[model samples]
Target: MRRRLIIVLCLAVVLVVAARLVMVTRDLPAQLTGAHFEGLRPEPNRLRAFLHRMPKGGDLHTHLSGAVYAERLIAWAIADGLCLDPAAMVILSPPANAPAERPCGDEAKVVPIADAVAGWRGQTTYDLLVDALSMRWFLPTPAVPSGHDQFFSTFSKFNPATGGSDWQRTLARTAEMTVDQLRQYQAENVQYAEFMVTLLEGEDRRRLGEAIGSEREPKAMLAALEQSGITAVVTQKVEELRALVARVDEMRGCAADRTRPGCGVQFRYIAQVNRNGAPAEVFAQTAVAAALARAAPSIVAGLNYVGPEDYRAARQDYRTHMRWIGFLAADVPVALHAGELWLGLVPPPDLDFHIRDAIETASARRIGHGTAIGFERDMDGLLAEMKRRGVAVEIALTSSDVILGVRGRNHPIRTYLSAGVDVTLATDDAGVSRIDLTNEYVRAARDHGLGYGRLKRFAFAALEKSFLPAADKQQQEQKLQRAFAAFEQEVTDDLAWPDWLAAFARALLPRRG
Candidate 1:
């Protein structure tokens, strides 16, 4: 009886200690931020400030080409002495054998970009070009009736400024663009990014397509590519990318003692394959992308299919494209632009199977846009499979709303979360959408009613689902944890009363009388 009594006393003591420990380690920051978030809905400025200070982990679905602002592109064009077609708001190459006095040629139809930007119609031309390059103040019209058309067409419109014809100039422009994006991300406290970029171009790209001509069998095509000295080309492309990275580092002053914020942020690339090309051309690009990924796994992390998914070539060759990706990317990782469609955008049958085929056939580790998840057949089953396989969906809220008209309750973000599928917020084309990562988090909280805790999960999900290596991922996870802790403490500190005010209140309190 005495021994039993002693044992019960010991159990009681242990329970008391455990309770004390829980109290000591309670998350005061999370609690404080939760209260702050609850009160922020009524104030837009405060809401933006709060989320802006919050740490965003990474953006995994960004397109490099579409991420540059129109103003910067125009500046580059002016520096190159390029011409502009004011009617189309498109940049044109300088004519050959052109006189130095008129570098853009003496044609009345085209004027120098510099002249257009500073002439009598300067402001008007500038505004039109900026609006044309992005979705700002857009409305349906006779020429470009759909948001979809306007969004995709912006790429070709600004292609000349992005170095459409000159390979050396293209490299320099790409490096400058990358540095610009990284610096922007750093200002918002984003720790990492995986940019989707197209590395092959010009004669090299043409030669690879010819070598892969008319080959239907995946293995045979891969074998032919191997025999066609594609390795040398891949080597050259890899070196070019390395040079680009070095240029980005130099521009950002990464090697200096006093470095820019962007110097600390980690970045990787995913080679892009254009889906609007001919079958052989598409296959050739895919093979080259796979080779690039394999050759430089550290720099080129993976491959993705870009271009509008509903294009004539993309829709007709969807299955074949999947097969190509499935076969060529056996060992490499893939993220596909699947189910970016909507009911009115395409025929009903088109939406039914895209997400499924991408997951089941192409082995996509991540799905971009995924706006048509509701229209996809076996919605519940597909969600289940995605959950089972750990496939993450990259949700671009602003881009989807602007380009596909998918937002609010109509978006499948809630559905995916309810079904236990992992989802992360991204900026599909930050410049094109005129938004950043913070804008996406704000949209999630304001539009979808996501609370602080749930939004935090989305930030962490981006890092966990990134294609970064395991060791690098772990390092980034640690950095994210530290950033959140500091951010939450700042919020709590803001809520605290001033020490002098507290003393004054204490002095005014009633005495023990």
Candidate 2:
């Protein structure tokens, strides 16, 4: 009877000890991570390394064309035998009547891209090309006087390489770009991405717009688009996108090894409708985007209106565009690039309505670069609506800082969070901005004084607020949770035993006999 009593007491003690250990283990990693974050605050490189390995759930605002580095674009241009305008730093197709060997003709100013990047002077030109193709070493100049101008101008400069006239080559380029971005995201520990790409371009898009003609009414326009065989086009495009993903898988060797970096990173597209285009063209693009999103929710996650929000056409027809989206994409998810504007970038009135209209009219699930939220007409009500609807705001720190000069306290990230609105970090144009997702997290920490817990919430919020289907999103969230567990445990292990603790433990041990 005494032995049984002792056994019961021992078992109770074990249970109590185990419970204590479990509680300690549950909170230990977070405590250690917070300490590590604070310790590494002064060390930018160490902080970046810490954040780089941390799992970022998703990059929901990336642009496929802008996500690629300039060096890769240059390589593609060389491979395609394209020309370079030295002074302009822009890629151009071969002159029509030029010989195959002399694609740029005998014009001294226009040299083959390969030739332009060769030798000593070529090295200098290559540097300039990289700068011209991105925001690297950018400063206000006579020709490109504003960061906004320099930022938007890069598309035209690199258009020849990315959007060539050859359909097959363009598709190949798109595939290559997708693979490149996937690899990049994997490297930065981004588990998922929703790349904004123009899937319906070239002849099909133009024809659809031409068919839409003067059909201003949404029902009539959608019917016109349907009668114009847009369904067939969407079908073909979906298959083409599937093939593109297959190509990406092949490129990443994902079929052979599921554990490959790019293989583990899942992605989907957000079809981009260029707001700078004519009204009919924009309407046609929006219609096709809506249809595509509905037809392939798994592949095409959603639709977003891209291009400069402050452009005359975009501003003038902003409300009309929202109305059109409201009608066409009633059931489809929308993530409009609203409120990317700033005070001087546009008139004050323009800022007041873009974000409001995006949510109230277009029913945007997310807002990309919502930098102008503070300038909206009903700021409090807008925040309330965003919070109530659970509409997330995608914040691209580097993009906002460089393009709109909005960063630090000027940024609306804190405001969004304070209002209970979901906020996620993204790389708007990582390549163009010369930043990765880690860079954004680092900025959030260093610039905004966010701790590890807040940053982790951002990571989780990215996946939670994504346009992914319920199952996919849940899977991604589970993956993110696993990643965080591993990451935190690793951090705890690294930080749990300091030099003093090790020394003390060694001192406490008995000497060898």
Candidate 3:
């Protein structure tokens, strides 16, 4: 009798599981039909939800400072005991002398940290600061002229809030900011990000430049730059980078078998050389980046040229900077910011050669912006080279619209695609631009009429063209492919069944019991 009872119980367990599996399988066909029907729309709400659920391969063009939103920056500032100059919308390390000007109200000459805190305590004051610090609540006002100026100018306003380049705090702050960004990416289903992180600036940068001196030859310059004690400077920054990577990994539980959302995603840093600086400074910065790449290959993989592309120094020494990059790129990789200008934004001559030079001279593996590709001399030839070399262009659709006022047909996305060049979408400054990776896809689909298949290819290209090593890139690609298959299964085979199927399963299952 005991043996019979155990047999019956085991049979009962098997029967229940079998019944559940049958019910799940019976409903799959109807579920797939519904999904097929819903997949036809290219409009907003539906498409946004679709892309949001889709796996984005990576975000290859995000900036660290511009990735953290304003509200968080303010919170960080307050926590750091930093005061706000509400009048100028700048965060300052407490007033040194006092009584320069009032923060919010004109009544007080100087606003104490306590006063600043109290002022921002109100929702309205906080919102005002958010608007000033980012593109949030942005409107064309007499005081603020163009959206382009407003977009770029936010960096200056929040520079003090980021605590500047004070070595003791810079790494910790950057790591925390990157962690926040990783959370955002995970929420959006993005699996990777390459941050354009600037780890050195101010006196440290100046000191490094002095050490490197003024050698113009690539070989000799690199040799001199190496022996100039610049490695000590780079070593200090590399230590910071290691600490940052370690903190992020810990927060994400990277070493554990089951990691959090943050750890599920991988992050790599690309050191950005400040293009607005002088030639020697640019060389020094490049050398430092090369060293970082050598010392911290796990975290730092590439170098970039970052700044206002239309700035005088960047335009004047454009080729020279590319030469510096080309020299370093023999041992490292680069993704340069080129052709960010528009027709009227800079001289026509500036627009004609940037994209060409970055590719031909710098041998940049990737091009960020590439907005002015249409204006390049021998545009056809350039497109062919891009295709031949498999150089991917990182398009930030939202920022392009805000800064260059280029969207829809005015944007060169179709040109790149039609020319057979590899293209991927990125969030140039998600926090500042108030947009995310999904927004880029949505814009690409809605405006450019990109189908689901075309969009998925963009995601694939992101990882394929990334700076990750061969084995890592292959592994990431496989992971992405798996994610896509699972997504398809969830939407097509596991969706809610039709009413008739659910009713049929319910009625049939009970009768079987």
Candidate 4:
């Protein structure tokens, strides 16, 4: 009889609390389902909702080489008939079946195409590594130096067949493949707020330096490509870029239901020019970026070259590259992939200047990675400048979490945040690094000991800090403001909170109950 009375008393209390919640909210969906989490470990569902509605902006610091996984690249290679050597672990050109010379790479690290495919089917470590390529956005460091090298070197293997592989056919095929993967990801809870694309292009210095028509050396090749028509080639590239960006945008924003409105996602472009390119090449590429920025609306951004960190040839051209960017960016808005260095991979001087030159000269409104900021001199002063200029720094949380631990509470991220330097989270090479923004967010919150408020603020910063235009960014800010107001009011107004929060706290400590 006593046990039955206790159960009835509990039921009555639950009903009274439910009634109180209805009275307070008037009629609204309960956001914080903390009541649902009765056990010791906190409820992550409420946390997930909080993150979902957090109004996170787009990811600005993304890379193409590391963005696409090696497995996908190898898959593309195998589809083209290229095979990987088991012992050497490098992808062969023209595939094994039937073709001419194509670029191959260092034998030691990467396996051949056929061996990889077989190993991949049997779930060998090679297959595991290849499978890991697409997952780079989420996973912890996968042999950082080796992975980085493998990622960059795989380019040579893909470049050759890419030309002979019926360029149009290959592009369309890749588009389909990209769409299919995004769909699969959606089914599995991968959320994308926005995507920015950077296409890689190499420039011809000697020819561009001489002038548009002066093909004095490598005359045969120059004659063939010129006959192929520069305007036509540029158009083709632009069209291909448009299609690819369209596909990515569509994929990222694809909804489960046609009738339902979904998240805000926009697509932007950046024309990447390598920092290590020859002056002539760099100048020409910059001109192309300016032109594209002028020509396309869906594409309103410019960038150039990606992996200068690996190019031993351009060690002395940092200032020259900055100057070239200045000339090119006189007509367009750009973001530079700057300061992504460490003590070992880049020389000391490079760590000092790459971040400095990008800001002082290149007119780069945004900087990707900027990991070496801790290593740069006068960093505090730089942070002040960044705060004053409102030049936001995009931090690759997925990548950084793997490498950076607490350099103290005032590590690079916290220092930037505390100093009022706008900091954003990014996934530099999601596919290769095997990580996504969500995982980055989770890790950042846990590792950095960040509160919900701080994480949401960072999400807000990431979007507004994007190199997107003033009008679009302003619109996004307003939308974010509305969302922020709602969240802020919820936290501040305890009465407005779900009755469970108040009831639970009250129950735990009541006055003369």
TM-score of each: 0.91, 0.91, 0.85, 0.69
List lDDT for all candidates, in order.
0.87, 0.87, 0.80, 0.56
Poorest lDDT segment (10 consecutive residues) of candidate 3? 504-513
Ten residues in a row with the worst lDDT in model 2?
504-513
Q: Would you list the clashing residue pairs of candidate 1?
A: none
Candidate 4 residues 1-513, lDDT tens each?
A: 999999999999998877765544552322232221121115555555445444455566665444555656666766666655554344555323332343234434444455455643645645644644433333335553444455555445444333333455545544544454444334323323333333324333344443543332333323444554544545656787787767655655555444222323444556666556555454555555666676664564666446645367455766666776776565676677777666777668778777777887876777777777877789888878888878777777656434432233434777777788777777766765666556566656555656554666676786676656789778777766666566545644544445556434543321220
- Per-residue CA lDDT of model 3 for 1-513, tens digit only, reads 999999999999899878766764675543332334234343568678878888999999999889888888888887776666668777666544544464333435334434555643656667777898888878887878888889988998887667665665777787788888888888888998999888677787787677657767878877776676777887888877887888877766768854576777888999988899878788888878878888888889898989899989999999888887877766788899999989899988898999989988888889998999989999999999999999999999998999888988999998999999999999999889988899999888778777666788899999999999999999999999999877766665544457345433443332210
Which runs in model 3 stand beyond 4 Å of their true positions? 1-43, 95-114, 117-121, 212-220, 494-513
lDDT of 2 by residue, 150-257 (tens): 999998899889967767777788888988888888888888999998877789888999999987888888889889999899889888878877787789898778
User: What does candidate 1 score on TM?
Assistant: 0.91
Any idea what lDDT model 2 has? 0.87
Candidate 2 residues lying further than 4 Å off, grouped into runs, are 1-25, 499-513
Task: Give residue 296's lDDT in candidate 1 (0 to 100).
Answer: 89
- Output the lDDT of residue 459, model 4: 67
Error of model 4, residue 378, in angstroms: 2.4
